[model samples]
Target chain A: MSDVFGVGVIGAGPVTQAIHLPTLARMPDRFRVTAIMDVDEPVAESVAGRVGARHSTSADDLIGDPGVDVVAVCSPHRFHAEQVEAACYAGKAAVLCEKPLALTVADAERVAQVSRETGVPVIVGAMHTFDPGWLGAKANWGDLQETVRVVNSSIVLPWNARYEDWATQILRRPPPGEPVADDALSRSVAVRDAVLGLAVHNLPHVRHFLPDVESVDWAESVDPYGYLVTIRGGGIIARLLGNMHGYWKPSWTLDAWAADQSLHVEFPPSYVQAGSSVATLTSDTQTRRFGGVEANGYEAEWLRVWELAAGIVPQGEDLQATVDDLIYAVRIADAAADLVRGEHARDRVR
Target chain B: MTEFADRPHLVTLPSGPAHRDIAAALASLPRSFRPGAGEDAIVYVTGDDDWPASVEHALSVARRAIVVIQPGYAQPSTVLRLAERAATDSVPVMIDYAFASNPAVVLAAAAWSAAVEPTGILDVTSRHAGDGTGPMAVLLDQLAALHSLVGPVRTIRQLHIDGDAHSAVVAIPVGGGVITATLLGARTELGSRGSRVRWLGPTEALELEVPHAGTAGPGYSRHVTTEGEQLAPTIYENAHRATLARLSRHLEAGAGRCDDLTTLAGHLELVPREHPSRSASQRTSDQRAN
Candidate 1:
């Protein structure tokens, strides 16, 4: 095995900076970020500088590099499927892509298909599957878990505004008559993607705790105000709670109950203090407490990729499971999209 | 002193967890009532400017009122304005150290004899509470000692003291109900005040004095069984270091601003025309000049 795999990073956004690059730097001997590819040259260059890698403005340049063995895709939602397939075609040994695997199942399936033909191991970036809290939960939960009942996950976004500070400024100052994609469908898609992008990171986590998810009969209700999801799988009904309306809820909260016991995990919002998460497990006799540990969601996921590639754990292959979970999450997303579209069509009809 | 029943409605302004804890404790009062969203008679203002008008708007009705001053942080101007407003309507005021970041407010508290409902504010500094000058940690430990002995049945209305030169007391109503243990820590400066220590005085922990039948109603007691000691040594140190670093940053910013670091208001009057030298001895003289 190569002592250090030269990894090509496909996105220079917050995820790459906050999660992927930091985790790679921590374990230098196992993986080295050799290059970065992003549509924005400056962003790619800046991220490359931070991680000490060369920059590529094009995806082809990044995947084609002889020094790059593994490709980590952190691109936008629309671009992930093509990028992943391209990296696989470029003969990269491992292609690790960020989750909500794609905007649609067709895109996710295309990437999945390319991986099947090229024989390159592809992992989605859903690191929550290996969360320390979840690990502790699994340990505390006994095997052959009796009937799984309810899984409640809530991701509250306090500052889920129309745009971030930078994006808001750009939108305000754009040149005249430039077609800005500002429509109900685009807005609804953004909302769906927020759920797909942020919420799906933890789907594998909820699934891990309740391992018998046979089918997901998901219902979604979304308006300009908020989004709420009800998903029933593995005899366990899960509620994903988030209100685009309110500003002060926790970023993520999950409660999973089996026949004899239940697990509760609360994750702090992004860029807050590390290990500031809390987890509680309650059975008939006792309740256990787990918190006061740093959280590195993005870094944790990247580390899993490195560890799996290095043979530290048996395949360290939770990403495939993540893709499967994303498919289920997309069903929720699709339901929400249909509701939103139907509402828009009704408004138009009237 | 116990003559006043729960007449002084405990109003806690929404601050961080500590303020929220105070609100929770006050809300849990058996005879306590939360004024409707638009029916706040008494309003409390703390550090954040998030919710005063909303509170004032909420208290659409009711005549009696109480306002808690955040000790050092509340401006003297703001305090006087509040005092005047309270006086205009004959509203009583119970000043709490909810605003310790501003010295002007602390000084302002000394002014209003009539407008201030309580003759003097309750100060729960470790120095006053007989705990040594270690920090809020030691004071919290002392309080925790009393907290450990209570069963699920006991609850105490506590005036919690920390090493920081601040004090806040809330009515804690615990009646065999599960108590939620919350953790709190922050960076702090090492002050020169002597500890309230003398030899250990009483075998039994102090009891919270409640004034009325309503205040002392069932399901609430002034005794809380100590939960286990939470080790926060590192957290305390981090907070202390951060505070020191912030202070140092402020000092390095410029002389006029750096003078704010001097806790005593008189010292603020003496900030010299020239920047004080880096020498600790020179800084002492600068302090003395005030």
Candidate 2:
């Protein structure tokens, strides 16, 4: 691998234009955009032209490009698994797949197996997991993982379009879908999507404390896009609440408490590069804060990716851990959906 | 609505740890009220222990008015019986819940109703120290605050209590739609003790932060609309002091009616029976056994 690894991105959506591209622009020495591909040819061409990289309408073309050393799979959810597998097989130094690695556990298992077989490391784009603030708290919080009794994750934000539009000028945008029905099946699916799409970013953090999830006590879908779920695991109870509405003030916070210590972290919203999350750890006698880093999670994750590809540092997260994270998210989503379905069925019977 | 011909004297009935705080609030009252003994005085009762019996005693003794500081829980039957007695006696009685009595709550409620449609979810989180009270008390304090801000809780969809932490999802009727409220109470010794209530609507959002009772820390309220975000002016008085001031105003205006008992009863009725089959103590025992 050369000093600067040439990169290929599989999707040119708002995330690519707003988050990854901007982050890559910050690290011109470590990485370079060599190829950009999207099913929308114009978006691929327009985004690639900005960085003076090659443009293509096929993922294979981008992955096979001789100049591309690192591949970023940023396509829709369903294509993430296959594209990642292709990138690994193509002998890329590393692959950065946007979250959910795959929707189904089977697909995740397959991706894990392929990564292990090919020896090409893959990192999921669950940005908060890589946030320096979260890392700092994790390093400093003593015995919280074992002793934590309660965990709460609350995410309240405006629509993504509000932030995406402010972050970058896009060449193409997907149209909004039809309204979701009020029935149980529709609600279950909506909540599942919410967990995978929005809450997935923080599930890794939640799982860090509640490692062995035992059961979901309650789950409900909040209208206009959100979910309220309570799950017990690792001798701790965790509540996850998320709502994406038209509210102007956006608050994304995670709080966990043990008998004698507590951790609270507030993450910046996605799309706009607003530095890193701010975390505070409080003990009975003292409180410590970590944050204000110039680099946000997106930048931090890319830096890690560059380091992993260049063999500067050992793989921080192995294939099995990645698969485990995916499985946990999928299980939580499925459990929540099943609870909603069951409640609705019981209600109908009554 | 006739003003009292003579200045209404204030008297206090002893209760629990909250008595000191209630007395501190009464000491700062304006010159319109004075300390006095006997039934003619405006009786103040801090219902921190045996609230039903204390309120019944106050109703029997007090002739002018009654003010009760809620200790976080009230039985529906007790509240109904007391409310009927207060109504028949034609004495105005106000139940001052710690969080709901904060002046900021009223401001936030008004701004929330005026700025947006009453059709979204209200998120509330209450954090308290483990030593102060049990989970049920903390949850009831939160629910009382919610009742003051919005209306009565219609139904409790789910309630889960694990040790000192309590969480519930309940619905509150608003306009033509129902606003679902997620009430979460966390008891930890490390963080500050307070309650935060938030309502997010399409074009507006409202947030209120009320500190635990007895502390004079200012409660904060932020209202955001399409134009911009506006924060209400901070009030330096604690909830107890504010409740006292409110009662003073009501007495001066000769208001003889209060629905605090009725609302308290309604909320008490809505709280689900404690996990149907297993008592909380039994569940704790089961966990220990496991």
Candidate 3:
């Protein structure tokens, strides 16, 4: 593979239209967009034309192209596992996919199994895990895992347009997906999707403070929007909240508490490089704030993919950890759905 | 304001939490407060004596009375018994919740209740430095202020909690509107302050922050309206004073029905204990009719 790898992205939707394109545009020396694929031909062509890349309605064509060294998967939830597996088997230098790894633990395991078999490094993108501030907390986190009392993760998101507007000015966006109707099949799918999409980012992030989740105590879907999840076990407890339809400004913070010390990390919204996440360490004697990092997690994730692409990562970089994070998110989501189901059952009895 | 002019004597408990501030708040108003009751009536019972009987005797002699409580440290049954006696004896009773008179909470409650739509969410938090049974005092104050902002909560959901932090969302369906309260307890900030009561209203957002409870200084506040920003003016520097002022008004109006027992049971019922949330919840259910 050349120093500058030619990329073939499978989905030309929002993640590509807004995030990855702007990110790749900034790193001209290491990466280049060679092809774009989408089921919607116009969207694929329109995005491909902007980056001077070829457009194809068939994802297989894009994945099989000789000029495409790195294959990035940014498709819908269902296609993640199969697409990444195909990229790995196709002898691509690197495979990058957005979160959930796959929707279920079984699928995530399959993705990991395929990656291990093919030996083509796969990057599962949950950007906050790669955040500089979070990483700094991980580095400076002395025995927090053993001594931690609680890990509280809160995110108050108003609307995506508030932050997404800062990243890309999309005059014409993709058509909206259909809302899940209130039915059995749809409800099951909705619960899983809510986990895969929303809680996946946070559950794994909280794991940095308290890695082993002994059991989830409680989980619920808030009235109209949001998920409230609590995990407790092994002398540590974690609470994660994600409100999709909040009417206030966006607020995101992850705080970990020890007996005398705690680490608080505040993250800016995704896609936008507003500022690095700020981490503050407070002990009995002194309080210190860390703001030294430059690159945001979005950029850092791309750089990590580059590291995997360049074979510069250290030994024992098990891709299974990424799969585990996704599984952890799925388990929490499943627990939340079960809680909602139990509430429904109780309501019926009442 | 000569409601208690003849027997201008007020009896109170230990001058801690909101008691001192309540006294100061009363002192600021004309003919609202009395310094002496001619008896040392603030019985430091420590769950040892008949607190209700003591309160009844004090109220029988004095014109009005105030009971201070730190719900976490004090017995709820003791405080409730005293408040119930004062209410039954037709004596004006001011049972001030922990730091309920903080100016920030007062303003946030007022703003939310006064909104045109009067429907919003209240986020009340306390910064604490303590052991694992964390910030229980602040949690009580938050619940009291939450009651004041909306009404008595009708629905509660324990959303997120851990060793040092406990978060719950409660909704009050009072009159024609519903106001939700989000309560969070933070265990890191060391100052016996750093409490916040924020209201997200239909027309604007009001955030009231208290750095130190019952301090002489005016806690910081910001109101973001559709037009622009407006900072609320401090009425009383301390919330205890505000609570006292409210009690005076209630006594003057001859308002009966003390919320003491119900509020206490509600809190002890709603909040999850460190070890046994289900048992506490069952206790709340069992004693709810009491």
Candidate 4:
């Protein structure tokens, strides 16, 4: 029961080198980065060297390191399930995993199963859902679930250089592979992964307002880099879309409408410490706006994860709920990719 | 095609007081303020006892566009046929939906295509705080705006409300997505009288809120986000002023009808052949017209 706990982070890439380490530095008194690991030994050693933590080329070695009290899975999306399962089985104080929460529904469920059996608190980094401003808005909205009419979300984002360059530069990252030759199945899967990557960030937030996603109406890829999806259920419909393009700045909004009341949540872009997301509610009698909670979700997320790891908070969220949220995101992605492929096939015939 | 020889005069048959408000609003304008026609821009017909007959005569004699202030379109077919005639005669027609003409509605419509393009799933909720709009007219006016956005709707499927005053969830097919409108007539405590239209796609999203007619303070057109915080002052004109201004633009642009019959046909799917049909504002127009 040491006051300062040890944190072992797997994947010493930008997220670790840039996001978590900086966030951990801000909360130095409560937690420490003990062991860092990545597939690339140089990246592991370089990032570890700066943070004063040991480096490992093997993820298991880092997870099992004696000084490590908490395990953070920040590796590629596909590795989330196994690494999270490994960390949970290792009985780390807690496990913090970045999202998609492991690509497929089955993988997500398996990871959930492991977390449950191990009784280790696991948190998915759907950061905006953790913001104080969003929590404030959620607290204020009442009876909207039953009365919501339409849910519309729009995100127009620019290049990542705005925040990416703010931290330590990783100049020697591996280049991305060429696009996989598109067969019907691979094209559909690619569309699913691509859509999920951008849109899932908000699915967790949208579910907070309307949870019943009975069926997907139509999901289409708008241009080269984004998707437009409409999901219906819970006596309401939700329209969700996000794109990465030439925005003057980041414009991301989750808007929910009801007969008398509406909720709007605006999220701050990633990798910065600007301010918390802003949420405003408008109703018949009055309109209320909330903001100035200067801590961003990225920072807030680390603090919360540290609190749970330190047994300071009641382990934040349940695995089942996280699984359902992750599954909903997957459902949206699959539905959208299926639709785009369907239209493509139909177009070929015509 | 060559342009009309002279500037078009605005012809508004004396329909009601609301009708007069519009005609007066137009007549008050000098020819220079309006396009084409000079100070002699407006002709307000006073001699006719038969309302429909006067419009027929006015349509023939008027040099340019015709204005129907709240044409109850009691027989939707009759007014639509007149619009068709106006189109054939190369005359533009403006059917003014005054409540919808507020600066907010105009500005939001102006912002739609550029800010957030719709990818099929276009949803609109038309609810009156205290049943702000009459039975079928509420659906029609809202549908008219929707037609402009989603192209022609192909079908409309209506769902029921439980023990509610008058609530129906109507889904209409347009393009790749569907336009769903939930019209609640008898719920004031739950919400105020206003219409919110939202367009959502993968790349962009937008929501526009239009308050019920005559609800706002004068000279107030401001842009606000979905959360109801004012964004900026909008370029707004009164719906009455906007309808006329739009007509002038149509005339200048050689405009005939705004939404064609095919578009109306798409809208007709939402209106049952025998829904309690009446022009909600025709009474106000009649009071003013006489």
Candidate topping TM-score: 2
Worst 10 residues of 2 chain B by lDDT: B276-285
Go through the candidates in order and give each one's C-alpha lDDT. Answer: 0.46, 0.80, 0.65, 0.62
Q: Candidate 2 or 3, higher DockQ?
A: 2
What is the CAPRI rating of model 4's predicted complex? incorrect
Model 1 lDDT tens row, B185-253: 111221211111101001111112111111112111121112211211111111112222233233233
Q: Native contact fraction of candidate 4?
A: 0.09
| Superposed model 2: Cα runs more than 4 Å off | A171-176, A345-350, B1-8, B13-16, B30-49, B61-66, B90-93, B115-118, B130-133, B255-257, B274-290
User: lDDT by residue for model 3 over B168-198, one digit each (tens)?
Assistant: 6666665586555667665654434457676
What would the TM-score be for candidate 1 when compared with the true structure?
0.49
Tens digit per residue, CA lDDT, model 2, B58-107: 78888778887654455676688888888888787887766777777866
Q: Pick out the ten consecutive residues of candidate 4 chain A with the lowest summed lDDT.
A: A173-182
Q: Which stretches of candidate 3 lie over 4 Å from their true place?
A: A172-191, A246-248, B1-64, B73-81, B90-92, B114-124, B130-138, B155-171, B174-182, B186-189, B197-208, B212-236, B244-262, B265-290
TM-score of each: 0.49, 0.91, 0.82, 0.71
Native-to-model Cα distance after best TM-score fit, residue A31 in candidate 2, in Å: 0.7
When sorted by DockQ, best at the front, the candidate numbers are 2, 3, 4, 1
Cα lDDT tens digits, model 4, A1-350, are 68788999989877776678888888788789999999989888888998899999898798888799888889998899999999899898888898867888999999888877887889888788778888888787888767776676766565455356556674543433344343556556666766678777788878876687787766555433555666767666666766554323466888777767878788877776668888988887888887658777777777777777777777635567789998888777878778768855764574
Candidate 3 chain B has its poorest 10 consecutive residues by lDDT at: B40-49
lDDT of 2 by residue, A1-350 (tens): 68799999999988898999999999999999999999989988899999999899999888889899999999999999999999999988999998879999999999988887888888888889888899999999989888888898988888888888777764255543555677889988988998888888889899999988899877767767788888986568788988887657788999997778889999999998999999999998999999868889988888888888998876655567878988999999999999988876775785
Q: Can you write out model 1's per-residue Cα lDDT over A192-309, one digit (the tens) per residue?
A: 7656756675666665545544433322333222344445444444555443322233336776645455566877655332554577877657778765466555556666666655
